[model samples]
Target: MPDRSLNADTVPAAGPHDVPKAQQAVEERLIDTVLQSFADCEDPRLGQVMQALVRHLHAFVREVRLTEEEWDKAIEFLTEVGHITDDRRQEFILLSDVLGASMQTINVNNEACGDATEATVFGPFFVDDAPRIEQGGDISGGAVGQPCWVEGTVRDTEGSPVPNARIEVWEADEDGFYDLQYTDDRVSGRAHLFSDDEGGFRFWGLTPTPYPIPHDGPVGRMLAATGRSPMRASHLHFMVTAPQLRTLVTHIFVRGDELLESDTVFGVKDSLIKDFVQQPADAPTPDGRELGDRTWARARFDIVLAPA
Candidate 1:
């Protein structure tokens, strides 16, 4: 029922007189040669992974009927991606994000953690040792955007409070630029705070705005070439950690944002979506912050963490 001539294993060896093996056999042989070359790797897992990678990668090449010119261009594009990478910019991660590998890997590696917030791409903007602020403090750092109030609690899967949980947050400004995007100032749009005894934390931030991923480098060129938009839905990034609990690096997406279904990095999930309610000036602020004549957005995002 199957075509034997195209079989990778049983195809006749190439020779002048015998019926010529399928050209596909040449590709299969190349895969076999590379696999054999790595067969003696000291690390069993590494060897297996490499062999599988070779098989799948070769299969994709054959499936696409890739051309020599296209392969060379791909090599050049990857080289450009590497050359553009540096301390501040991560072109490779951007590439992975756009190609869906980042989210796929997250799904496979983090599936065991149940009822916990789903993990997503840790985009390149995360910084170490963000400034610590108190509950009810604002992380906007004067970045200039529509006002927003964010309140939430950290709880375990069983609905118990996770007190003193460390909550780290960051986001971009209304103009689609992060604090990292500014050379003169790299401190806005990020903060860390600890939850109270009741497992509650509150803060002030800006409403999430749709913004394009950093697309000025090779990643941007690739997006343009592939006819894909670089826009990510409005979201607030949160990384929550507590003793004996798993850390969650995730986003709280704006419920009605137009780009929710088409986040550039494929990070949106139904569980992560939340309604960002718009409030008038007379509405009572969660923390009683005085707003005499201002309208703002409010969103509540309670986090559930799994055990480590």
Candidate 2:
């Protein structure tokens, strides 16, 4: 009745209505807009996700009355973040870490812990296809720091050994730097090993030190803007997968690592800390090598797998 004669062709698909109905009408319009935005998406799952994203994003924009200037600045930041990504680096992941999105993702996907080891975030620094080495071998390559013997067992939650499990492990060196971050020294300490026939794995490395992640990019700018340091605590990363078992990605943190309470990415949890024990030089290493005149710290922890 209201303007049907003058602007009959200009009516919105949704009508301006009673105050309560107004919101419902707008929501319906938004849903339709989201659906149309992803109409050409190829992946069905991705399409669904993108549609949801659009709906939420639109809602946020409307609720906040986001201004043109602020939105343009947001776009500029995201564009620069993308520009900093490369084959071995991901600035988007860095952004996610600082914003706590990466930790949220880890919690969402790793929902089970039936005697199985708890899972944690896979940080932006993973390297695919690291060098493989034998169990009980020295991975440290004498990088000057506290020596530690890292030994562990792979087992099912039922207490049975999980033989043939693939254990991918890597850690920062003595000065708290990853081999890749400093040099192309592929020959350095970071390496991979597998559980033996008895579901046991072993290696040696210098104690990890707290170090800052590269803050030379857009992510760094964000951290600086927020007064946050780019440092991560000393810890070792492990990913293990076995037959009919769930894959696990987690970190074994140094008990005394100062950044445990303030891990730059908020990735630290008390349950993940492990002690590195100092032992006399005469003690036998897991390798049966005489701990010849070398003081060492020994840490033993096991990973329990969940059945598929």
Candidate 1's residue-wise lDDT over 162-243, tens digit each?
Answer: 9999999999999999898888855989999999999999999999899999999889988898899999998989999999
Candidate 1 Cα lDDT to native: 0.87
What's the C-alpha lDDT at position 155 in model 1?
Answer: 94
- Name the weakest run of 10 consecutive residues (lDDT summed) in model 1: 11-20
Off by over 4 Å in 1: 1-20, 112-114
Clashes of 1: 0
TM-score of each: 0.90, 0.83
Tens digits of per-residue lDDT for model 2, 1-308: 66433342233332242224455477668679767978998899999888888877776775565679999989999999988897667889888987888988888888776778888888777777677879877676545577788888999989999998988777777776666666565546567788988999988877677888779998898888989999998887888988799999898888877789888888886777998877888877666767669788888879998877
> What is candidate 2's TM-score against the reference?
0.83
Q: Give the TM-score of candidate 1.
A: 0.90
Off by over 4 Å in 2: 1-32, 39-44, 141-144, 280-294
